[model samples]
Target chain A: MHSQTPTCGSIPPVPARAGIGGKPAHYAELLAARPPLAFVEVHPENYMGEGGPPHAYLEVIAEIYPLSFHGVGMSLGSSGPLDRGHLARWRKLIDRYEPALISEHIAWSRVGEVCLHDLLPLPYTDATLKLVCRHVEEMQLVLGRRILVENPSSYITPKDSAIPEADFMVEVATRTGCGLLLDINNVFVSATNNGFDPRAWLARISGHLVQEIHLAGHATIRSGELELRIDDHGSPVCDDVWDLYRETIARIGPRPTLIEWDTDVPELPVLLGEAARADAAAALSESPHAAVA
Target chain B: MLPLHEFQAAMASYLSSPPGPDVSHHLKSMMRPSLRSVERRLAVYKNNVYARLVDALRDSFPAVERLVGEDFFRYAAVQYVSITPPKSPTLLGYGKDFARFLENFRPRRIFPIFPMSPISSSVTSKPITRQTRFPSASSGASETATACCCIRLPVF
Candidate 1:
C-alpha cells in the first residue's frame, strides 16, 4: 500500500471561505478571472477516465487552487462489501490531485449488480450504523485519510430507523474517526419534508467534527396539499437555508463552505456571487454582536 | 424489521418497479408514516433514480435525444432503464448499449441515416464538455497541513 499520506507537500490547505463546484462550463472564465475563492470541489467520478479533457482541465485547476474531491458514487451506506476497483480508481485520482479535502454521502447509489447512479437513503439503526462505520473505516484505511461523511437529504424515512439522523452521523464520525461534511440545505430539506426542526438537528451534531459545509438550492415539488423540498442544487440558495447557514456559522464558527450548483449550473459570476454571499454570512457571523442578531 | 441488506434490496426493487398501488404496498411497510401520500413520497426516489440516469443518458447521447424528441427519448430511456439498470458506478460508458437498445426500441426510426460512426467516436473519445482555452501553466507552491480523507466503497 502507498504511504498513508500521499505526497501532498505542494497543495495549499482549503481556506475557511466560500468555494464553488468545479464545472466544465466555467473553466475558461475561472482560469481567466481567477476569482478570489478558497477552493473548488469536483466529483471524482467525472475524472476517473484515463486521459481526457476532464483530466487536462482538472490538472490545470489542481495546479492553481485547492481541490476537494466530493464523491457521489461511493455508495457507502450499502450493506454489501465496498467495491475495490472503485476505491482503487478513487485512490489513483486522490494520489494524483492530492486534494485538500475529500467526502462522500451517507447514502448509497449501487445495490447488488445495479448502479442506481443516484444517492439513495438508508435506514438509521444499530446494524446499519455498524455497516456504515465498517465501510468508512475500510475507505479510510484504503485511501489513507480521514474522509468526511455527509448527511443525506431524505424523502422517505425508514420505519426501522431507530437512531436520529444527527446522532447516526455523530456516531459514524465518532466510531471511524472521520469528520462530517454538513450540508445545511439538506438539513433544511429533510426537516421540512420529514417533520423535524433543522436547528435542533444542527445542534445535535458535534460541531468540532464538522470539517466542511455544503450550501445548495432545493426545489419544491407539490402533490395536492403537500409540498416537499427536493435537494436539487439547480438554483440559488433560498433565504431560509441562508438563514440556517448564518446561524450555523455563528454557532460552530466558520468551516470551509461550498456552493453546490450541480444541475442547472449558472455562469461563473452567479456562482461567485453566491460564494460572496457565503463569505458575507461568515463575516457577519464573526461580528462581536452577531449572536444578538 | 428486515435485515439491512434485505431492506436495501427491497428498496432497490421497489424503486425500479413502476409506481403503482402494488409497488406502494410493498414499500408502505418499510416507510414511516407521513402526513402526505406515501406513494408520492416514495415516488421522489423513483423520479430521482430515473431522472438522474436519463440526464446521464442525455449527456452521453445528446444527438440521439435530439433526433428523437425529448419526450420520445425519455419514453425510450425509461424502458431501457427498467430492463437494463447500470451495473457500474462510472457513468462515463454507462449507456454503451443505449444505441443497441434504441435499435430494439424503435426499429423503424431514422437511425440508419444518423451518423453512428461519429457518435461512437464521441463515446470512445469521451469529451463531455466543450473545449476551453487553457491558460499558460503557472507553477506556485504553498505549504499547509496534510489530512487524509476516505468514503464508502465504490465500483469503477
Candidate 2:
C-alpha cells in the first residue's frame, strides 16, 4: 500500500516568474543543466502509472525544482458525477509528489463511460454552474486541497448560454473557492473567435483569485471571410498574445507562469528559449530598469 | 424558440448528413441570407469540425497517412467521422478507434503488404523484431541431443 500524506492548509507560494511543463525527454538535461526558472509543471495523469522511468526521472527533478500538477483529464465540468477511479489515481499521485500547485480545466470532456478526450466547453447557465461547483467541491474534498481551474478555448458557442464567459468563471471560483489558472492564450483565442475584447474580459476576472498563468502558441485558419484562430500550440508565441500576457501580468502582478507546447514539440533549447522569454517579460515587470524605460 | 438540445440534435443531424431536412429550417433561423444560404454556411462549420478532427488524426497517426497517401486517408477520415462521430469532449482522445477501423477498411485492405513498424522508421531502416529464445544455448542443444540420442547414436 502507498503511504498517504496530509495536504497543506494554505496555497504553496512559488516564484513569480516562469516554468516549463515537465517532460521525460528533458529529464536528464533538466537535472544536470538546472535551467533558470521558477518551477516545473507536469500532467498528473502521466505520473499516475506504476513504478517506471517516468517516476524515477520525476523523483530526481522534484529534488531540484518546485513542482506543479496540472491535470488534463478529471472532466471537472461534466454533468455526471466525478470518476472515482480517476480521482483515486490523481489523489495517489498528489500524495506521492506533494506538488505546490494542482490544476484542471473549467470544462467537461466525459459523459458516463465515453471519454471525449477534448476539453469540451460548458454552457454558462445556472444549471451548469451548479453542476461544475458540485464537481469542484467533490474534487477538493477528495484531494483535501483547492485546485485551480483554467479557462478553455472554444470553437463554437452554445445557443442557450445565459451568462457571459467571464462572469461564469468568476461565479465558479467564488462558489467553489478554487483559484484560477488564467491561461492568456485561451483568453486571446476565445475573445478573438467570439467577437469580444480580451482586455475587457481579463478585467472582469477577480485578480485576487488567480494563482497561476499559462502562455502558449496558436494557429489561424481562414474560412472564406471569417478567420478563426485555433489553439493549436504548434508554433512560437505570437507577438500580440505576448503583449497581452505582459499587460495582464502588469495589472495582476506576477504568478507562477507556464509555457505549454504539446504539438510538434521542438528541441529542448527552443522550448526553454520560450520559457526564458517569459522569464524576461516577468522580470521586466519587476525590474526597476523597466520603470525607468 | 429553439431549445439547446434541439439545436445540438440538429447540428448532429446536419453533421451526419449535410443539407439534411431537419437542420434546414433551424439553420435558416440561426444564420442570415436564406435557408439555401444557411446551408452553405452550415457546410462551412461541418467542414471545419471534420477538418480539425482529420488533422488531429493526421498528427497522431502520420505513418497511417503516409501509407495511404493524403487524399485517400482524408477520404477515409471523412467517412469515419460521418459514421462514428466523436462522443468525447477531449479532442486528444477522439481518434481512439481509427486503428481498428483502418484494419478492416476495404480501401486499406488493398495495401496488404504494408508491414507493422515502429514510429521512428523515418530515421532508421532496421525493423524491430520480438524474440523468445532461451538464455543458454548449451541447454537448448542438450535438450535437442537427449531427444535424438535415444533413437540413434550414429552421425557425423
Candidate 3:
C-alpha cells in the first residue's frame, strides 16, 4: 500500500529545452560532466525493481536535473482492464521520483495475461478512444498526476480502424485532460510506412495540449519493394527527423525535447552531442528570424 | 472487421506464429489494404516483437548465448518464445525459466550440458547444486530458484 502523497514533495516542471534519455551505462559519466540540460528522461519500468545502482544513480540525477518518466509498459490502450498491480508499482515509482513530466504510449503491449513487450498498435475507432480515455483517467487517478500520452510508430494499419491516427490522439487528450508527448520521429516513421503526410499529422495535433517532444533515430528496412522505417531508437536523429522536430518546435513553441537512443546506446558524449543538437535546433526554431524566413 | 480484443488476439497470434499460409490469411483478414503487401507490413511487427523477447532472454542468459553462439541461440530463443510467451509487463526478470527451457530444448542436446551450469551462474551467480538442494517444490518454485539463484560458482 503505497502512499498517494508524493514523498519527494513539489517539484518544478521540465523546462522547454533539450534532454537525453537517462541510460544506466552513462550514469557515472553523466554525473561527472553534469552537463547543462533542461531535464533527464527515463523509462519508469527500468527503475521498478528493488533498490540497487539504478535507484542510487537516479537519486543523484533527479537532484541535478528535472526528471521525466517515459513509461513503455503501462499497456494503457489494451483491450483488457488496466493491471492494478502494475499501476501500484507505477504509483510507488512516482512517489519516489516525482518526475516533472510523466508519460505512457497510446498503444497496447498486453493481451489477456500475456505481456507482448512491444508497443503494439491500436485500432483507431470510437471504442478504442473511449477505452484509452478511461485508462488514462484511471492512471491519473492512481498517480494523482496528469500524464502525457505518446503516439506509437506504427507499421500496419488495422482494417477495423475508422478514425485517423492524429484525430484519435487528439480525442484522447481532449477527453482525459491528459497532455501529449509528440514524438517527431514516430510521426515520420508511421507517416512513411502508412503513406500519410507527417506534416499533416502534426497540423491536427493541438499545440496547446502538447507538453513534451521526442526526437529519435529509426532503422530503414527494405520489405519487398517497399521501405519500412522502424522506430528502434538505435542511431542518431536523421536530417529528416531533425527537420520535423524543428518545424514542430517552431509551431508548438518549444516543448521539453528528448533525444532518445535506447538500442546500441553510445557513449555519454555522443548522447550529449545529440541533446546539444536538439538545443541548437530548438533555438534556431524559436528564433523570430528563422520562423519569419 | 474484428472487435478490439479479437483484433489484438489475432495480431498477437500472428506476431508469434511462423510465416506461412495461415499467417498470410491472418494478415489479409485483419490488416487494411494498402500499396504495400500485407505480409511485408505484418513482418515489421513480427521482427520487433520477436527481437525484443529474444534480447530479454539473451540478457538473462549470456552464458547460454556464448556457449551456443548467436545463430543457435536465436533459433532456440524463437522456439522458447513460441512455447513460453512472456507474462510480465517489464522485460526485467522476464526469462527466468529459460535455463530450464534449454534443458529440454530438443534440437541442440549438444549444447545442453554447458548451459544450466554457467547460465544460472551467469544470471544469479548462484551454484546450481546448492539451489537444487533447497525445498522449492511448489508451482513455479523451481522456476523461481532456477531463474535467480543466490549461490555463485565460477564458470569453468
Candidate 4:
C-alpha cells in the first residue's frame, strides 16, 4: 500500500497571495515576466501522461513556483468503489511535483459503469456524506496528505438532501481531516441559483478549515424561469464575485487565491492583471483600516 | 428516504438514455418546485453530459474534426457518445478510442497520414498511443500526438 501521507519534503509552500490557473498560453510569459504570484494551480489529471510538453513545461514551472494539484476526477461521490489505478497515477504526480496543496470537488463524476465527464452534484444525505468522507480519507491516506475538498456550484438541489451545503462540507472536512478550498464565486452562484444568502453560506463554513481560495468567472444564462450561473471559468471575474471574494478575504485573511480563467484563456498579462486585482483586494482586507470598511 | 445508489441509477438513466414509462417516481419526489422545473433542472445535467463529452472529443481531435467538417464531426461525436460514454471522470484518456472510431469511420481519413503509410494501420494501437515512433529510424522529424486537455476532466 502507498504511504498514507507523502514521505518526501522537497517543494516549498505557496504564499497567501494572488495567482492564476496554470494555462499553457501563459507558460513563456509566466516564466519571462515572472509575475508576482503565490503559486499556480493545475489539474493534476492533465499531467498523467507518460511524457509530453505538458510535463516538460510543468517541470520547469514547478521548480520556480509553489504548485497546487487541483483534481477534477476520482469521483469521490460515486457509490462505486474508488479506482486504485487512478489513485496510484495521482500519487505519482504528487510524489513528483510535491505540490503545496491538492483539492477536488464535493461531487461525483461516475456511478457503476458510467463515467459522465462532468462534476455532478451529490445529494447531501448521511449516506452520501459518509461516502464522500470515505473517498477523501482514502485519497488523503493514499497521497499521504490531508487534501482540500471544494464546494461545488449547483443549478439544482436534490429533494433527498436534508443537510445544508455548508454543514455537509463542514462534516466532510471535520471527519476526514481535509481542508476547504472555498471558491467564493461558487458560493455566490449556488446561493443565487438556489435562493440562499451567500454571506450566510460563507459564515456557515468553519473558516479556519479553509486552506486555499478559488476566484473564477461564471456565465449566467436564463433557464426557463430560472437564471443559472454556470461555473465556466472563461471570462474576467465579475463585480459581484469580486465583492464576495473581497469579503471572503476579510473573513479568511487572504488564503492563496487563484484567479481561474480556464476557457477562452486570454494573454498572460490579462491573467496577471486579474491576479494583480486580487492582490489589491487582498491588500485592502489586510490593511489596518480594512476592518472599518 | 431514497437509496443512494438507486437515486444515482435513476439519475444516470435520466441523463444518459432519458427516463421511460417505468421510470423512478422517486426522481420527481427527489426534486423541488414543479414537474416542469424538475425537467428544466435535469436538462442542465443532460445537456452538460453530452455537450461536454462531445466537446472533449472535439478538443482532443481538433485536426481530425476540422478535416471531417463540423457537421460530420458532430455526427461522429454523437455516435461515439451513444456507443461509449465516458467511463471515467477525467477526459484525459476519454477519447483514446477515437482513432479506432476514425479507423472504422467509413468517411475519408481526416488525418494527414497517407493510407500507404504503415503508421495509419495502427492508429488505435499502443505505438500510436504514445507518439508515432519508428524504431528503425534513429532521429528525425516525428509525428506527434495531439496534446489533449479540456473540459472538467482533462484525463480519465
lDDT of candidate 1 over A185-265, digit per residue (tens): 999999999999998999999889998999988888687677988877877999999999988888888889999876545
Please report the TM-score between candidate 2 and the true structure: 0.74
Fraction of the reference Cα-Cα interface contacts (below 8 Å) that each candidate reproduces:
0.45, 0.05, 0.46, 0.36
- Per-model TM values vs. the true structure: 0.88, 0.74, 0.88, 0.85
Q: What is candidate 3's CAPRI-style docking category based on DockQ?
A: acceptable
Q: Write the per-residue lDDT of candidate 2 for residues B79-122, one digit (tens) a residue.
A: 77667765533342455667767666677656766554422322
RMSD of each: 6.5, 13.6, 8.1, 6.1
lDDT of 4 by residue, B79-105 (tens): 777678766555556677776676676
Candidate 4 DockQ, CA atoms: 0.26
lDDT of each: 0.76, 0.66, 0.75, 0.72
Best-performing candidate as measured by DockQ: 1
Question: Which model is ahead, 2 or 4, in terms of lDDT?
Answer: 4
> Per-residue CA lDDT of candidate 4, range A1-293, in tens?
22243333555567889877776656776777787789988887677665466777888888788888888778889888888888999989988888888888898777786877667768898889888888888988899877888888877788778899999999988787788999888888888777889989988888798989888888877866767777777678899989888877887687899888766667778888899998898888889888732
DockQ measured for candidate 1: 0.28
User: What DockQ do you compute for every candidate structure?
Assistant: 0.28, 0.06, 0.26, 0.26
Model 4's CAPRI class? Answer: acceptable
State the lDDT at A181 in candidate 4: 91
Over A144-169, each residue of candidate 2 has an lDDT whose tens digit, in order, gives 87788999886556555778888888
Model 4 chain B poorest ten-residue lDDT run? B140-149
**Ranking of predictions according to lDDT:** 1, 3, 4, 2
